[model samples]
Target: MNNIADRYLLHAAFPLSMDNESKSTTEMICIANKKSVQEQQLLQALESSEQRYEIATKITNDGLWEWNLNSNQINYSSRWKSMLGCSNQEIKNSPVEWFARVHQADIEKLRRNLSACGQGDVSQFEMEYSLLHQDGNYRVMSCKCMAIRGTEGKIDRLVGCQTDITRHKQTEARLNYDINYDRLTRLPNRQLFIKNLQELSQIESSCLFGVLCLDLDRFKYINHNFGHQTGDCLLVKIVQKLKSCLRSGDLLARIGGDEFAILLAGFERADYPAEIASQIQQKFSAPIEVENRSILITTSIGIAPLTNINDLEHQESSYSLIEALQNAEIAMHQAKNKGKACSVVFESAAYLQSIAKFKSENELRAAIELEQFELHYQPIIKLADRQLVGFEALVRWQHPDKGMVAPGDFIPLAESTGLIIPIGWWVLRSACAQMVLWQQDRPKSKLAFISVNIAGKQFSQPYAGDIIAQILTETGLDPRCLKLEITESEIIENVNVVLSTAEKLKKLGVQLSMDDFGTGYSSLSYLHCLPVDTLKIDRSFVENIESNIHELELVKTIIKLAQVFNLDVVAEGIEREQQCDRLLELQCEYGQGYLFSKPLSLAEANNLLESVNN
Candidate 1:
């Protein structure tokens, strides 16, 4: 092969380096001929290589650039100039000239970053900034540079490439917004809320701040009646109201559907946050026009105060916000249970006391998963025939340490925490399975059905029908033998979804009953609209049966209503013999509660059933 010196000279000057005019044609020929055949062959190889590189650079669309830090001169490829809608003549080889083309809004940031590289603070440079096109439009450009340091460790040369990443940047921005903001209402989502909370927590101040978690009460009922689209529209309208009511600095976020969180920072006085929350509650209670009807919406707000300001001293970190938010939500749910349209602020002492209970809820969740819950069946007997009809499933928690826990103490807590869905499924499955076991032993008794009281939240679950269907199929229990009981208020609140769910169950041959019938403003027309097989007279009416003539009349009317609809009638909470006689007198088909027996265990209930049938 040729010498390295000849090959290097031949290759370097092959493409861009043209023969000098000062050099005569004879001198050019003498220089070319003086080389041996091997060197000539190397020159030919170098020329071929230059042609390929020149062709490749010209064909590719990516913009390439070089910057000379010493002279502040910049050289950009022809395609690079074209990328910014500029001609070759318009391309000035100066950093200042390049910065001038950068969008004004992004210039300062780009300057700071470049300054950091000049000061030896940064070794490499990469930035995404906007460049003004010749057409006066801004296109996003991504620049990547390598700082060439001299022997003194100072940057002497910088080379970079600028690519038009406008489309990619737009896509990235859209993705970021979709991640951090709610798509329906365009409000900050839970992730963004936590981030803001963390940032706000870092301010060096003695002033306290409050985190209020609010949920639109009975939103599921609205969704069930008006459809999800209308529900979403209402949520968006609610978000607008919430935004209007907030202070300029306060952060409002839609953390979950129907759930929101607000950060009230820099409160000088402790009561300020509470006052603001109360004002917000009042504002939210105002009616909104939807579907050509003015509908009043209420929110349940729970507030927790931030005591430690130094906790989040970093740019982004979550501390106590998520926990505080969760506690506020729990307290809000507690207020909702009292009644809707209420607000509760978290007291540290009260929260401390309640934290144990909340922890126990998680423990109870584990217990349910591990099958630590036991079912005690309460007998419902035929008062007229004095024969056992069916059993009501009552859940008892046999806590490893706390012993037996009452349903009243924990069921509401479970419902609020979303643990009720699993618990309710277990109840239905266990009850149906037990009923199947009973039928196997005593096929002759011919008990009417096992009644499982379902909560409103459980009934509202999207997969509730599937849960019941699976339970029935898995246990091999006749669906007709399983009575899924619900409250009158639950049905009345979500009348449409309730009716739809009831029809779905009825198609599977499961009996539907409205429990505590007279307690709510259930219209007779609604009763027929729902696919119910039975109406349960509330125990309140039974307790005052003989003493109150009105109670007796009401019970009689309910029984007559049931008869007219060809539905079975049962009176619950029957505690007295006189109440039983009154119910029998009213021709109520079935009765339950202390009149016959309180909720018993499976063994006690089965034994009683066997004896009564015998």
Candidate 2:
């Protein structure tokens, strides 16, 4: 090993410019000495090369290291030790001390990679791992290592470089958090929930998982009345409570505003799931005091147990948690329909039945669009005059298969699906057309108005006013022949729109009436402002008109109140002669019910109108 020179290849050389002079100076030195002039010159050149290499390394903050595997020793570069918040003299220079500072969790992985390097296996010498700083904080380091093998094909020495990457690692972690979590609720969002669910399903062996679909009932009412800030505060409170109800292993997710979902497992019996759901439902039975106001809240829950992840067969290629959640949603709606503050379980057969009902609705909609619906007008006669003065337009669905379905069966469905808009429009047009025809046949008959009921959604549409005006104009019937009836409950929700539309209809010369009075939300302020021409006392009040003297007096009081407002009074559902006679005796201007005739078709109503004049 005497006078060992650098044994390396250098094919190209360029002049180094120093002091404004191009000199053929040596950029690198090679030490070669073997009793030859050339070898001795290389020895001096190699010695000078060391100073330039050290300068470049110091400028870039790059620490260099050499490990001698044969000696079982590891050496750390000065810069590497300095980057760890330490100086060269303050820390040991061996791999043992290096691993000592490494986080305990990452030590095994670092050891595994280092062992591969010792065996001459292909390994990325440069890597990143966390190290404990002098102050006990963690710092990330980027390491580069290259193997130096021996003549016997065994490792001899290894050299590497290390750089600090703590800032970069911190930035990456912050971005990952912002991407995966919800900002407002501070919970794992839909993205993170599905990811966690996927990971959990792979490891769990219980073969049982349940998805609970939780929707806040009347959450919209809170938002509407108290404003969105209060609504958000209430939602935060709800999220905390729902999170508390679940076990540590269970996952709670805020899937949407006013809606949450929970995945539960580790249950011994189906009753366990039911009991948990019941507990959540009952928790909100007490009022939540917010902003000095007591606000009552409740939840509708639908739960579906997943026997296999693929129990939901209708889902697309990547079977998702949302599909199971959707099944839970259908169950929740069923709970709501049965009445809120209850939990409903998923029944596959019953769910199929609901799907079938949905299909029937599509068919019913087609029947409505194709003019397959018919109007049945129930006569409202004067008990004393025995004359038909008006007819209540009852809508009937003439299904191709199920003929003449009554309003009692399909009307509620129509209202729920919002198909009532088109259906109500058809009813108004057809009823008005019939009234015009009836007047044509009996010129001397008492003038009768066709009363049509409007749905709440229909009244809310922006074009409702224009539609009514167009229908009356097209039918060539006096606007007086059409009486537009709206429920009291609907007017309370949208009073301004109701008042504007009612005034517009009145200006067009059509009459307005409030239907089903007193059974709904009791708000009398709308009654004064709604441009109503008649107040049809609901059928329930009329049912006990004779027996219940209180109801009898109430009916007389309604008529007396109407007289003061210059509004006519019509008593609905007058069945018995005594009820009709009582209404007439109370001086009620109009009476309608089964006693006159069950709702008749347009033809029967026309004939009844003919008899009025004869």
What would the TM-scores of all predictions be? 0.58, 0.62
Screening candidate 2 with a backbone cut-off below 3 angstroms (N, C-alpha, C), the clashing residue pairs are 5-31, 5-32, 6-31, 29-45, 29-46, 30-42, 30-46, 31-42, 31-43, 32-39
Clashes of each: 1, 10
lDDT to native, each model: 0.80, 0.78
lDDT of 2 by residue, 428-451 (tens): 998888888877877777766889
Q: Weakest 10 consecutive residues, lDDT, candidate 1?
A: 311-320
**lDDT for model 1:** 0.80
lDDT of 1 at 341: 85
- Provide the global lDDT of candidate 2 against the true structure: 0.78
lDDT of 1 at 450: 90
Model 2 vs. true fold: TM = 0.62
